[model samples]
Target: MRTRPTTATAAAAALTATAALLLTGCGGSDSEDSGKDKIAGADTGASASASPSLSSSDDGIERPEVSLPEGDNLIFAPETTGDAKADAVLKDNAEYLRSIDEAIGKQNPKSEAVAFYSKDSAYLGSVEWISGFVKDGVTVTGTVRYFDRKVSFSKDGSAGLVYCADESKGYTKDVKTGKVNVTEASKDSYVLYNDRLRKNDKGVWQTTKSTSDRGSEVCQP
Candidate 1:
């Protein structure tokens, strides 16, 4: 039997890449889906601390607008940050994962999973890989590497997390031999997940999911 242990290491490294992974979104048609998703809603006016107003989403990444729908979803998000939320979320999540990297070894899967999420690894789990997306009047298409991630804002506006697969490169795991083999010829798709939060009650966002990338894919909803 092969005792190659890189799978665990790779998995751990993947946990760190949660921020980079959660950007994937399932494909949708122009008729069914619009350029922007309507904000669910929030009562942040209650706080008097509002996010700065932005002009446009011409920077490449789409700026999700937060507006009070007819009810709750919209109230929570009057405006969306210009990639600020996604960037900050990724950065904070990376920091949190680094802090616990050595702490959460292979021995702890469930605990490590939670640790990863608490650190804000966005949508690092429950992903399906397909390819491409539409953003900001621009259809910046991409070949779905390995999977897709879902993004959402928390109810309190203090937290937001993602659940996506992290298919960084191409490789395979010979479980019978316990070997995580790699090769340039290996381009078949496999899904992984990365969940990250913007803010947590504990003060810092972290990973939320990513048990395994064995089976998951991007879904259209």
Candidate 2:
């Protein structure tokens, strides 16, 4: 029953009704400009070395390994915050984002990485997002740069993270035709996200709730 952020605006129209509804928090409107930057090529296959390392919980619950396919890049700036807890939250958050892409690339609604990184509304929202891509027969490509990431802890021991995503160079690709639908960079190309995370007994920070605003003034360059 909770609402979460949607994906890029470039592909929102193509998504299913259920998916579109579930993904309202992270997308933008089409009235923006159209100037895109060149995207760099990425290596193919899922490699642990290529993705964020898994976080082990105190309960010894084995975390699922997350990986992305070719052309799907997630670049996070300031990989570390010098604070252990903050860094862990950032790393796990990156993993959660990566898991969504991984599920879409694999066309699997039941993704282990996704299940491992999220729970409750966040988890359900992610499944719907991946299902949308699968039903549309499309997958994501190109690079999504996440920067200006900041994390803070609440008195109740929950963590809140805010970050910006530059999705200008990313696009959706047709699975059957292998055609890439690229879009130009505009105000909508950048998104600002606010997420709530809680560390479980296993020592993993799972995203519980999230919200996003595309073309947010704070995220604009």
Candidate 3:
């Protein structure tokens, strides 16, 4: 894990870099234009304010429930892919993304749902990512839209997914002061994510690894 900064601005930058490297597998220097609100986290007990939803797989595997903070929202477009296998992959993948936010919302780095939906590098990276939010005393607010999702299966049985995130409407709020750091929409607000997932014996497609590109031309409108 990388060292985190103490200052608010520096902390945000460090967190962004950490996410790109560990969680998203995008190794490089941090972008100056990246917004602090691009990531998600929450105050303690934030999850209690929202209703927890259970995500179940077709194979009768029941995933842990996940809930987000009141103001924080993640929207996924084209909820169903028409194909059964692809839909299953998308469902679990969406849950994986949601579980990360749920962990942040609960301020728990070892969130059950997060562990249930991911493993290996994805799991370790999520823990470190959530820890950054917990230490910063910041929580995400507003909405983050995920769209243009495409999925494919490999010969080895692993699944691949690519998607876009629109974070222009998202903001990071200071948990103590109730201050929201809002930013205008820009190229940096759009992000592209490429992920790999494998179905476990439990019938859950767990995210194994992922890579992201912020301000990628493909993600921009």
Q: Can you tell me which runs of candidate 2 are displaced by over 4 Å? A: 1-61
- lDDT of each prediction vs. the true structure? 0.30, 0.68, 0.67
Greater TM-score among 1 and 2 belongs to 2
Question: What local lDDT does model 1 show for residue 210?
Answer: 29
As a whole number from 0 to 100, the lDDT of residue 86 in candidate 2 is 83
Alpha-carbon RMSD, candidate 2: 12.6
lDDT digits (tens) for residues 1-221 of candidate 3 = 01111113323344344444433444432233222222243221212222255655456765677778768888998689689998988888888888787677678887777777776556667788888888998777788988877776666677767677898898877778878888888988887676667777667787766566667566677
The Cα RMSD of model 3 versus the native structure comes to 10.3
The TM-score values for the models, in the order shown, are 0.31, 0.74, 0.74
By TM-score: ranked, best first: 3, 2, 1
Candidates sorted on lDDT, descending: 2, 3, 1
State the lDDT of candidate 1 residue by residue for 1-221, as single tens digits.
00111112355444434434444333211121121222233211112222233223344322212221111110111123467665555544443333222112222222232233342122221111101011111111111232233345544443334333222332333323434444332222333343323344423344433244333333111
List the candidate 1 regions with Cα displacement exceeding 4 Å.
Answer: 1-81, 98-150, 158-160, 166-189, 194-203, 208-213, 219-221
Clashes of 3: 0
lDDT of 1 at 20: 40
Per-residue CA lDDT of model 2 for 117-155, tens digit only, reads 776556766788788888999898888888877776666
